[model samples]
Target: MNFLLHCCPVHHVMVLLFTTMVAMEFGQGCTQITTCVPGQPMINCSVVTHDSNSDPPIQITSYVLENIPPNSVIYCLNDSAFFDTPGTVTYAASSDFTINDAINAVLLIRSPNREADDQITGRVTAFDTPDQSEANLQVIIIDVNEFPPEFIAPDVLQHSLRFTEGERPTNSLVGRIQTSDVDIEDSESTVSFRIKGNGGDEFNVTRMTVGPISFSNLLYTYDSPLDRERIAFYQLTIVAVDSISPVMTSNPSLQVNITIDDINDNAPQFMGDHMFFIPEGLEEGVFVGNVSASDPDAGENATITYSIASSTFDREFTIDSTSGILRTSSFYKDLRFADNMRRLTVEVMAEDNGVVPLNNRSVFTVVVQRPVRFTNNIYMFELVENNNPLVTVGNVSASSPDLVSFYYHIESPGSDKFTIDRNTGKITVQESLDRETSPMEMFIIAAVYSNHSDLSSTAIVRIIVIDVNDNSP
Candidate 1:
């Protein structure tokens, strides 16, 4: 902040001057202080000391001065002047230094100049009052971080250009980001100045000489902010060498990422061989020729999605989402189909789903399916006991490419009491059959099938009955 003096310093001193003094208070051994101007009846001040027994109020009861004679006069007020239970006394700073509740003598403060400095000497006289003493207590006010730079505009990153001592004109708000640490503006601690990245005119950092600068500035403004892009990118090497033991520092720089964009303005052209003939009479779901195009734009705009140009395929075919392969979704008759011509020319196109900068289009020609067969094959199956029945058998490695469904049925000798699963082909016996009646069981066909009602397959099982009991032994 700039200031205008109301009057000259020499003239201001002539206005008026005054003097003041301190005194011990009243009440038993306790002391109080009162102020008095220069000629205003110089009330002779006196000091005294006493403990709790004396009533008046005093907590700490002892203190030591430069006890040596000619320097100070010490005395202990004989009475007992103790403070409250908390042993506290009002208007009292700390109870640590005192002589038996003794107070100090009154002190006189002198006025000053633009710069204020003063020296004082005194006798303890009484421990009751420190106001008369030379040892002093001072309070310091801290500063905050809020000052706006004296230079209205902080240096912005020079993204558009590079910096060279003589390359461009001087005073060019050279690549600099200005900021401040001195807060509590309007105070002496707050010193604002226009900031220029090159260490500013105030001082240039030849070797990081600290101490001289306000500790506030040095301790706080350690890191300088930078606009990476505008200045293109900066490789600032900051080496912090501390004087303290185990001093260490890091001289690090950074490589910023910057991507330049391209202009879209160009129309997408076609890619790959253009000509290909497909057999006539194409049907839905046919794969044919693939076509694609690309953009010169960056990011999403550069990525190309496909579609059959509407101008060409008002309603023609579909294109693969990823492969760009084109295919017919509907049947189309050959323009020459009237003369047994089964081929028709239809266009398929691709379109992009670019969120921005509009969509790009491409087209392709495809062949459709005519007539094709997809025969079914049998999967291997295994036989298993139904557990509910004496035995069960399931499909096990058997099949045929026939239209007929697998008509699984029991062909065992006890067919009336046996059945098999149509799908799993697990054959099971319904009743407990006595194999002894027919000691040698043969031709127990457990399954039958016909893929096309014309195709068939079968399997049989034979069991050898054994007698466990002997009659004549």
Candidate 2:
């Protein structure tokens, strides 16, 4: 029995030694370790040591791909595992690393976390080559603190905000402040916001927390009514704090300046008393004195538009909307027959273009003086015989600014071939003219007001009747 036990123990030892040799051959073929960034694709097999003298966190570290064997295919073992990558990242496996390609490929690693799996495990297998072997790959992932939270659209740094006074409602959204932490998305890399300055009570700011993979945004709202006259602007400081405990103190802060926009609270006012003098029979489109006023508001709120609110004469004058220039649009008429002081009153109003408009009205008394005698006296015309005889020949235009209405008549010795209208002074052919009878005709046309005898003017109208083929020769 003792001899049998010895033989059995020897056989068992042989079996154990054979198993150990096979395991060593499989796992220990070539256990090569190389460091690389997480999202980065190429595996640098070169032996490189960190330099404590230079800046520690550098973007790229050199890798010697020439040491890797030929006909070798690289395999990433963590295909099914999840890992953190900064920004949008992609991976590629290549046999030969060129100088340009290696530099570009190194940037794709994104923000790799050193605390996590800094080095990835992979396998390099060779085919159809002597010393064909399977080797272990160790890739070190490099961590870079390159990303900081940034303000999104409506960059608070570049833009200024405005709110109308007494018009904005409470809790109204004034502006939105947003920030993003792009690199190494994790609990330690999260960002938060807070407002940390004066005027905090005037406005309310709310922080909206986002997920680990997203960003943070803040909503700023007006909490009360603002009086621009009392306080026109507000200055506040905002700070962005990261989730990193000690690092939060080193984050960024922003100073915001908000302006309160003005509203139209005061009406336009006339400067002086109302009465002025203008002579009767003044020409149309004549510039009257300008009406001046002032406004307490700013920008367009101070702009005034002048209008003729009421006038004894209908549509007799026009006022400029911008320049406040008042001009006559029609001939001036005397009102002395009514037993008054020959005076005219017009109501002028001024309005401001503001968020809410304000207006003021003022009365203007214009004293009418005696008009000068009419000076325009002569008018001439020519008519074609074949033209529609009922159509008007030309109007006998005369200067009589003081007369509201006038009568026109041909004086004695005037030919009955043409007649003048009593009101419009328009002359028409009473009958078809025969140039053969009177080739040239002369008439004295008189324009006089029926009510006022002094307002009268006469013109010598010479008519040339051209001969046409109307007569059968």
Question: lDDT (CA) for every model shown?
Answer: 0.33, 0.52
Question: Model 1: per-residue lDDT, tens digit, 1-473?
Answer: 11111111111111222222222223334333233222222222222333335323222211111111221212222222222131223232222223333442222222111122221222222122322111122111111122222311222423243432212224222333222322222222332222233332322222122466431111113133222222323333222232212222222211112222333433445677654444444577666566666654445545666655552335445667666776655643332333323333444343433454455443333322222121223222232222245565333334433222455554546467656566665555565444345454444342233312212445654434445443356
The parts of candidate 1 lying over 4 Å away from their true place are 1-256, 261-268, 310-316, 321-323, 333-350, 359-473
- Lowest-sum lDDT 10-residue window in model 2: 5-14
**RMSD, model 2, all Cα superposed?**
18.8
Instruction: Say which candidate scores most in lDDT.
Output: 2
Clashes of each: 47, 3
- Evaluate residue 228 in candidate 1 and report its C-alpha lDDT on the 0 to 100 scale: 23
Error of 2 at 277 (Å): 11
Positional deviation of 375 in candidate 2, in angstroms?
7.6
- The C-alpha RMSD in Å for every predicted model, in order, reads 19.7, 18.8
Cα error of candidate 1 at position 456, Å = 35
